[model samples]
Target: MSKALDANNRRWSTLVWGSIPVVLLAGALTVDHIPGTDVRLTVPYAAEGPGPTFDTLGEVDGEPVVDIQGADTEDTGGHLNMTTVSVRTNMTLGQALGRWIATDDTIVPVEQILPPDLGEDEVREFNQQAFVASEASATVAAMHYLDRPTTVVVHDVVEGAASAGILHPADRITAIAGKEVSTPSEVQDAVRAKTPGESIEITVERDNEPHHETVELGENPHEAGQAMLGILMTSEPAGGVTVNYNLNDIGGPSAGMMFSLAVIDKLTPGALTGGTFVAGTGTIDDDGEVGPIGGITHKIRGAEEAGAELFLAPAGNCDAVKRVHTDHMTVAKVDNLPEAVAAMEDFAAGRDVPTC
Candidate 1:
């Protein structure tokens, strides 16, 4: 009985000692090195310059469409394959700490760099609401011919906005509080340092006339920050040239040209919406120049699948857009908004409009 018990004890001890290496091997194989299993990869839109790599922020099962309608006043120069995206998700505390250390060493500090090209005060004073307003009112005339000569800027100051109580966009900020505000940082700093719920006077220039507004201060959402006034202000122009256009297609912002053309057509004597679903994607500047936007092929695929009778392709992206287009999909290349609208209107008159 003693000999049998001794043999059983030896077998149990061996089994306990043998499992450590097997567990370690499994962990190593299934750990950080596994592709798709452990780590995921993504392509980001960024300038082709040296910068920190970014991660995905969010994803839409199907892409959202936008209207690229507006005056093409400023020239974006040319389109590039870069993109900017917000990042989401954080790793473990230990991994995050390591990443933070690396970023501190590698990234350029915002404080050390110069302010935006449009200037500091101009940046801080930009209004989101006004931009939407300007987008709605901006329209084109046929004889306008997309005035692409020079860029002009105008800012909109909605009459009922928070800023409307004190100022407008085209009203260049000459000073803030008691200090002369020149840059965006100074304007932001002045506003930020003020006590919550206090009112401060702002000086602005409108049509060469100077005016002052005593704005009631509000709470700043940031930690320990002063009171805030909810307002959007920008140095961007509210109206300008009508350079490029696509006719009669107000599908998405990508179809800005089409929307603009439709606006022009409706505003004018003739009709532009060819009465069919017109789909497209691109940036329409104030000069009416067509600029390339990301995810064109994906957008085209979406439009085609949606059974769009006509697709307006950004002139520069014709080659890429054409590659995926079929006989069922008629890709009409347009330079700007007016042109797109025209194409859509024409296409509709030819084909029976698809029922809702």
Candidate 2:
């Protein structure tokens, strides 16, 4: 009886030990954070002729237009490049572990990347709205640099927001409370001055005709005692100059600064890039303010791989910039559009520039 019991015990121990390896293997393959990688930035000027992506300024109504140069210059070696990150979603446990071991990529919880309640369609819609906002910001920046009048227009209305049914996409908000506004902050201030649930008069220009609508203000979800209209706004050229951005599939406002720079480069004479490959990522506003963006480390890697010698990083993102491998590229910290342009000019002139 004692011998038989010992044999049964040995078999049980062996089985338990064998199962440990399988469990560990399964855990290793489990999902973790999304992986981010570099995507090449394309300049729209490289496109054939003027269309949805490229814009060429010409005489409008017999008025002389800006003499834009560098469309045909072959030796113009510089590029106003934008940066993007490749996200790896629903990764297995083993794959996540591999990414962690590689150290070249980052791991983030799924919830951190996206809200748990958001569906795929909602996410896509959000991305599309972001793209529109970026285009508007870029257009405004360029128009501002050109000293042209611009207007802040509604790009997309957040679903379930106060303005969802009251406002539509592409509707240009001309004024709030009978006072004309041009920038987003002005509109916000106009709304914030009012109490939540108060009705405010909003004038929007659609199809070249003005229409007035009464919108009830809603409480700002982020701030207490603040009123919000629940719409995404963008800048549009009030003048005859038109800027059309044609990059498809790519979303987010991170490319705003780069797009603005690209437009400025095309509108002005000579190469703003200083004849060297330059890449950057930042959210630009109509007021020329630069805002921080995510996936900057991945963008840095992308710029480095694309043969970019200079990188323009938003000042707010210095911490992430410090943690990334910049390799041989010079990373310059910029707070606004003017500073960015100056840094690029300084680099092209072989002068020392600011670095983060």
In terms of lDDT, the best-performing candidate is 2
- What are the TM-scores, per candidate, against the unseen true structure? 0.37, 0.67
lDDT of 2 by residue, 1-356 (tens): 69889999988999999899998766445523223534322111111110111111223235322232323212233566677777665555556556667647767766555567896568778888887777777778777876867787787899899998889998988899989988778898999999899999999988889999999999998898898999987777775456666566677788888878777776667778878878888999877889998888878887787777898999999998898776689999999889999999999999998988
How close to the true structure is residue 171 of candidate 2, measured as C-alpha lDDT?
91
After best superposition, candidate 2 residue 222: deviation in angstroms? 11
Best TM-score goes to which candidate? 2
Candidate 2: regions farther than 4 A off: 1-77, 152-181, 184-206, 209-233
Root-mean-square deviation per candidate = 16.4, 11.0
lDDT of 1 by residue, 29-144 (tens): 33434445755322111111112111011112332121234432222111111111122222333333344566422222233222436453453344332233223323322223
Q: Output the lDDT of residue 338, model 2.
A: 91
- Per-model tally of clashing residue pairs: 57, 11
In terms of lDDT, model 1 sits at 0.46
